[model samples]
Target chain A: MTLLKAWQMPIILGMVLLLALFLPQMQLNLYVQMVLMYVGINIILTASLNLVNGYLGEFSVGHAAFMAIGAYASSILTVLILPRRWGPAEALRVVPLIGPELANGVYLVPAVLVGGAIAAVAGLVLAFPSFKTRGDYLAIVTLAFNMIVKSLLENSGDIGGLVARLIAPLSASLSADVLRLSDAVGGPRGLLGMSKLTSLFWVCLWVIVSLFAMRNFIFSNFGRGVVSIREDETAAGLVSVNTCQVKVLTFVISSFFAGVAGGLFAHVLQFINPRSFTILKSTDILVMVYLGGIGSLMGSILGAAVFTILLEVLREVIPLVGLSEVWRWVVGPLLLVTLMIFRPRGIMGLREFKGFLPKEEEVKPQAAPAPP
Target chain B: MPQPVTTLVQQTLNALQVGSVYALIALGYTMVYGILTMINFAHGDIFMVSTYLGFFAAAWLLGLALNMPPLVIFLSTLLFAMVGTATLAVIIERVAYKPLRQAPRLSAVITALGVGIFLENFTLAVIGPEPRTIPPLFPLVNLNLSGVFVSTIQIVIIGVSVIVMIILDTIVRRTMTGMAMRAISFDKTIVPLMGVPVDRIISATFALGSAIAAVGGILYGMAYQLDPYMGIRIGWWAFISAVVGGIGNIRGAFVGGFILGFVEIFTPVFLPSSTYRDFVAFSLLLLLLVFRPTGILGRPIVQKV
Candidate 1:
């Protein structure tokens, strides 16, 4: 029993890794696999959003903006920047290492991280305004940020040309490449024909990494400062929490994870558009965050899973019950309303599931000295 | 070539027409926020529902084939939409918002968003996705004044909006109910102790706000296409207008609405395409928020340590 308890985390992680490696190969129904893929992406989105909204107590209604940034950045890399002749699957087919089929998955990590890094930088947009604004004003700032990002992409067609023209004086040949790259974004129509690089193993691996990263961050000293700021900003600052730094770092970290999810999402659909990351999409993330419970990591996982599955089930069941698919949209919000009315703090509220609790939190209890 | 004065005047008129509708809708947002301090995310959808109400009312009135005067048809449709939308807003307040009054503010905001989605999708499900418009109740007359053309519809829309604004301003500034509202907004806990019917006042706020949005809806439907999802974008714009002018402030909403109207109308003139309209509007909002966090007219919130 002692040995099992000691190895609990690794055992569970090993099991998840094993499952991810074989799940796609099981030949599950195509639609089922796609739904599972969405479930994974949404879980990542919910977890990252929870860091800012749940733990930090800031209402960011524009997480999708960061997701869009990540999506566009990674998609541009894979589809436009990478040499056409060096397609991952073809180049790695001869290498018998990590299985030729799975070798292509190697490129996806860096590409997605690059997307995330760019999105983390974009996080400054919200972080700076947050210094002064709070509540609804901050919410509006996030909403405006979402709109600005979407419109920026939508107008990228003209923007690209303008940039190219501006650069024409510097170097004619480089300007041509800049214009071509911008055209590849596909404007309002959306970027398409991305190589299907996202696999179950990669998604599972990233999900584990993100969940672990978020879990540790929340338990760290900085995370304590984040929660303190949420509870009472002035008090936190009085206590030497460095409230500004904590808030900015929290936003960036949250944005980074959201971007990572976006990268995976782009490759999953093998297409992306600005419209895909609208306020409505952000609202969907918000719904999941609230539904799961604020300030609870486990709640995010449960909320994302339940919300995604419920919608998928409704999509199937509504048509079977003599209602059109459009009714699912109506039913979805109706369910959310009922949920809100019943459980105002959400399912988990501020508590965590037993399995998700840190080892010391669950095991040591009264015997352990409280950290100062 | 330099821009002609006629083109500038034509655009200014267009801005006024759009601004009137935005100002009307922004009033609803500002009022509700003033009383409750909650963003009524569904207000835009209420505006949407009002337009549909106007559409059906106009359709039914014309279908009667009574040969009623055009003026009568327009008035009845407008009245029907206003009453119906007001009732809807009151019901939403009682059912969705009232229970969450003691809950966290974010919960109320989230519920408002859910209500918004429900309203939008409910409309989509029942009405289908095809966009609709109210048939013209009165004949339109385009009057050309020295190369600048103005339509009678534009005149009516601008005229009615200004009249409504004056009436609403008078009510909030002068009437007992408006005094109660302002008192409650100042201190909700103290006002009820002073004999204000808090719930009724809140419901009244929602009704008044929704009614004003209905007027804007009817006016907007007369000039533009109406769809269920129309509320989301327009609502956000009006919400921005409210924030830009300083939320919870009435006159500020008016000013912010016109600013957004000018942005929308003039964006295409300066930028390559109208696609940059949202970009410009949102950037303006960001800049304004950074410099004037409380908005143009909003008093800065003093943090109490």
Candidate 2:
């Protein structure tokens, strides 16, 4: 049953992709396309976050840390490897160690995958501590990880200096250039001068991939184990599920995708700063997950799309309506509180589209048995 | 030797002052966690909002319009800020949290995040994009206690914090409401069966927590000046303190705050580089969680079947 539902989503996704491809032409506006691109990135972010918060039942508030890792890693690679050209041949030559022929077509995808993998490694650092603590402790550990990442990035100059000193003997001839390259990482000032490689196609494609992967993970046997652990860890353990393994896996997978989303965002904005990835960003993702309904994959996608649009709309409409910027904060929380109070299960809860759709018999109504 | 001693004394006093503020904020976190088992992420933002409130009241309303004496103006502003923040806390509990009482803990956590964002952005909009100066209420006077030099404001902050802690401890131990709060924490379902008003107790808890947070906010504003983003860093520290001390343990929160404060202040001094302060503090927090999840003073909460 789940597989059939999963198969159906890709078809819908393909249709959406086709529609998005023609949207710019239809609307004749570049700004709208930019907004659409942003929405796609957010879709990737909120969907992947659902894997941890919704499917795994772990509260992770440091997702942006992974995002930062991915952003920096991918940005560094792209800046160093990719030639500053839009032509097919130049793009091909820039691909790392690949023959010029295949590089142009496949290099971007590989870069994104590598970025995600790097973030997954970062996730391990955060997940190791989770073996001992759960709930609020886990939340604090993750929060600390976020702050630590930010601080480290802000203080990357000191790290660079130490590395330079260590390698001074080996690279005496090229020490100055190496130091300059290290400074390119830009410490607290932030990473600048990166090419904007994130386009609508890449963003939308990743969003689809993330949505599909999260949905499959949630419905699979492993997904059931995650839910079981969430419902009752002891009971799940007694029933033979390795609760710890499930948690660690879920966290890593979620972190990997968050990293991918971050890379996409960094490329889209063409800038990377430590301040950009803070607890506030994590909170935004969390809000999307909860507002959509915990454990509901489709709901998360919808929630992210709605929220990104709403934020933009609010920014545009609020000032026109004579509401101050302070009012924006007021409205966001007010809406969230109202949603929690009235629809705590979110818009979908654990139920899915199939569950909501009326049965064939109900749709037809059996004609009331001809007034029997 | 004398110079080192003076430095040590100054650092110690600084640690105490900062630690007291953290303890005040952590109380709100610990108290709420004790009952609801939900981390009120917005508590830190509430602290931020209170500082702004105090700032506006002091600089704009009292300082500019009323032309009152600095001491009287400061006291009145502080009082108003506390009341305003307390009301905000109660409203948050009523609006954002009360509905999620029976819902999953995750939902409440998310709502708390939402509330926090709301408070932050609201302050940003109202306060503009600049950090405002808070007029000094008390004179910056220092005292030499033996070889240690401590500022008058620091001493006052520490003294008031201790008094507040003692008063809260007494109320929790010696009052009917405190018993009711403890009862609810243990088994919320049985509280109503025992004929207690659970809602009232929870509101009181929020009110009490918010009041303490307001004091912390005002003091923090006096110390560091006022800004919307000030709450973000301090809030994280306070949250860390609550967790390090054991989330639901009040006294543990106090101890955790002081420990964190000392770690933050002393790490920089000893390392001769302030850059690694966050690294050391965060690493310590993670290690503590791994070794003693319940913290120094916190007892483990037993999970029910």
User: Using Cα atoms with residue i matched to residue i, what is each candidate's TM-score against the true structure?
Assistant: 0.97, 0.89
**Please, what are the lDDT tens digits per residue for candidate 2 over residues B247-280?**
8888999998898889878988887477788878
Model 1, range B93-182, lDDT digits (tens) per residue?
A: 999889889987788889999999999999999998998989998998999888888998999999999999999999999999999999
Local accuracy of candidate 1 as per-residue lDDT tens digits, A1-372: 989878887789889888877877888777887888788899999999999999999888999999999999988888776646466444665776577436656667777999999999999767887667567766888899999999989988888999999999999999999898889997898888677888777787888899989998998888999999899988898999988889889999999999999999998999999999999999999999999999998899889999999999999899999998889989998888888888888888899977666776676545777699
Predictions' DockQ, in order: 0.83, 0.68
The TM-score of candidate 1's chain A against the true chain A comes to 0.95
Who wins the DockQ comparison? 1
Q: Give the best candidate by lDDT.
A: 1
Candidate 1, DockQ score (0 to 1): 0.83
